[model samples]
Target: MNAEQHESGSWYWEVGSEQCPHGPEPDYDTQPEAWDIWIDRHTGSPQDVRICLDAPAGEACLQCSEDDGEMVPWESCRIREHARPKQGVVPNPGAEHQPVTVLVGTLECLDRECDEYFGDDGDEIPDMESCSHIREEQACSCQRQDDGEYSNDPCPARSLSVTGGTA
Candidate 1:
């Protein structure tokens, strides 16, 4: 199954496979049965290559009709819808070109009993990483290894991802 199809139906290339699910070693009479052919706009022009596109859906697909250029798995080969963009027209901005989602993880102590979590006098400690008391006094086994050497794990803080405004 294509992982990108769910994100966006737009495709960079149409991929097909014919490998068998039940394989007692399926017979391969040919050397390499599968192929991956991506849209190379530089190879053909709009006039020479008939191109169609679903502009609203932002979907563009191509197939080899006149010539045998479409790549398909040997077993199930069929002519798929062929689409190309007009010359000087930009291709679909596929799922890969969509805006990025950035998740920033921040650390904070979840244990209410830990003094440094809030602070000794009830004023919240600004930085838990700087709160050395937690490493010595609290249940932060991640601070050091059993042999007493410094551990690779960061401070035993509960990581939280928060947006600027409440959802």
Candidate 2:
């Protein structure tokens, strides 16, 4: 997804951002094609045919000067990890069923109806700077990239969690 590849092969990967003497260096871009191949071969998820990073406007990095460019977690925009029902996957009629892991996130709403949250036409808007007062950080029950473990209130932040499912 990197429109500008700095080196022969650099897609930023785990090296998200680093603090240097010249302030935070721009997060480097990394190879995304490798992920498509890896997901398909390892997970056998038919990634090329079914998987994609869905970026809602609220989650996009609008700070970049270029309006038209590839999106891949460049500045404040972190392509959040999420999933949806895969299409074209035929279910096995005879396979035993079990509970599945379902992750739920939180959305902080205004204490009361705020006019700023709506557009001029009366429709609800998304990620407008005017509506920032109504937005809230997702309660932190996020996974730790370093340890790969789920945390509930890990440190100063932790969101709710759903149990009974194996990942």
Candidate 3:
């Protein structure tokens, strides 16, 4: 995925500003570096490539204006109506503006059927690498040993099973 459509893209460029708000003076670095610094502020770690932002209710609905200044609040700026979701062909404006009720940090595993990956205390199973027995025999796409040999534990299917058990 590219930067343009991501939340990070909003702060990816200094535009009319002379320097990044958090990094070395704008004079010390190139435009791209300034952008990288700006994006880093909203992220938890320096290595985090993407920052998931909640486009404030009505703020992210408007497209950035050409005359808009560099220091304006980008996260709250409305997304351009013409901008489309990169993963898919068409942009669904209706879906885009809907507030995301799910926050990342508080999410819990709810899959009832995934007893092997959960503990008696109703928490995610510890030692995910050794959960599945079958996983020991099958290598992952990286062609390495399956870490979760006892349970085949944390594949995409099993990961989501943490919440309310699989249907």
Candidate 4:
């Protein structure tokens, strides 16, 4: 069976190999140009179709690139007018479903009030207030104890824990 696009952009397919006086005309808003439309030979109804928008200007065959890595023009390709899947046949569901894992956690950082200082390499810079270069370090306003602990106030560093999911 063959199909044609009307001037009004509607699609119609031939009833059989030979043209019938009365044919089925399916009205589609847009034309299926350049793509091969698979139709049922007996009913002249569309089953499945092949479309390749990325195909350069004249290429139409979907397997052109897969066959020889060369695009076959629509005009040059042989049109398989009678291509349709068997009626009422279901396709196989490939692959088993895998369980999805979910995780929940909190993200926290040290507050600005915390006087923790780190060097350019991310190593903790000790004794910032007593350092000779303390004047050069803008963030060095150390109020920490000599034992490297927060003096009077609690440590502002937050502890994050995973409270949910398969940890």
Candidate 5:
């Protein structure tokens, strides 16, 4: 039998050929036979076989399709989508009035208890004037200290200003 050695060092023999000179061996399996045929027909290496087998059906085989000139079976091998520049908003010419800006400034708090008292259920206080903890005319003393409680000192009221365009 004609003896052939695989990468694993296992020897196989062609049935009805000259017996292996060294010792008895099993008949060549279909996988080895196909591998030899593929190598011979495509003039490809063992590594090429691995690449073709590992690659998905419609994707490019790295070993055979690495060259730019080589043809890939898929329509496109690109994995990421192309990014385009964002478009800016265009102002409407038919609009009757221009945009206005409203500025609301709140009193800055130094004390942690005052800060929590200003917040509604852990969220920022929507309107500082609406909170019962705030003192309308008096300046902040910054002396409030207690857990889950508000002090008698009320934070100063915030000023509101509206600008831009005729109001």
Candidate 6:
């Protein structure tokens, strides 16, 4: 850290690790030495300067001297991609004695209100093709109540078949 008095106000700037044009700047060995030099030129304590550093850069820049102002740490903080739920209408029920057929498809964030699927790109979609719950037929096998004795094979009950979807 280094400071120089200007006409408007004094300013502080840090030069660290990197080689300076004039060999090394004053007190370049350690952060404490740099702090000492910075304090000597400024009127605040080291703790005060540290508080400023810990604060968010947006507010820090607003309050701190323009020459020493730093930008917010944007690179350190960012939102990563999130898995969004795909959307599609469930198929309607089929005719009598037949189970309803449904084809589960994936839909990107198309509606503005749905938070789960809201996305900027229309193509970004959740994996609906691999969902095991989606089957080709609604119901395949049937189960019957077992008799007390063994070999309680009974008539199969009416069941729906899975038509299509991710499966």
Global lDDT scores for all candidate models:
0.28, 0.30, 0.31, 0.27, 0.29, 0.29
Q: What is the TM-score of each predicted model, taking all chains together?
A: 0.13, 0.16, 0.17, 0.14, 0.14, 0.14
TM-score of 5: 0.14
lDDT of 1 by residue, 53-145 (tens): 211223333222113443323111122211112124332344322212111111222122345567557886666543332222221233333
What is the C-alpha local distance difference test score of candidate 4?
Answer: 0.27
Q: Cα miss at 45, model 6 (Å)?
A: 64
- Residue-wise lDDT of candidate 3 within 29-146, one digit each (tens)? 5577776655545343233332223221122211242224332343323331111111222323444222111111100111122456678888876665322321112212221122
CA error at residue 131 for candidate 4, angstroms: 98
For each of the candidates, the C-alpha root-mean-square deviation to the true structure, in angstroms, is 24.9, 18.5, 19.8, 28.1, 28.2, 23.3
Residues 28-143, model 4: lDDT tens digits: 44534311232222232132323222222343443432343444433222322211112232223341221112111101111111224557777766654322211111111122
The lDDT, on a scale of 0 to 1, for candidate 5 is 0.29
Best first by lDDT, ranked: 3, 2, 5, 6, 1, 4
Tens digit of per-residue lDDT, candidate 6, span 14-122:
3221221122334545667765655453343322442222222232222224334443221111121112223342223342232222322221112222334334675
Lowest summed-lDDT stretch of 10 residues in model 6? Answer: 143-152
Q: For candidate 1, what is the lDDT?
A: 0.28
| Model 4 misplaced stretches (Cα beyond 4 Å) | 1-55, 79-167
Worst 10-residue stretch by lDDT in candidate 4?
A: 103-112
**Best-fitting candidate, scored by lDDT:** 3
lDDT of 5 by residue, 100-164 (tens): 12111122221213464455568766555332332323222231222212233433331223346
Comparing 1 with 6 on lDDT, the higher-scoring candidate is 6
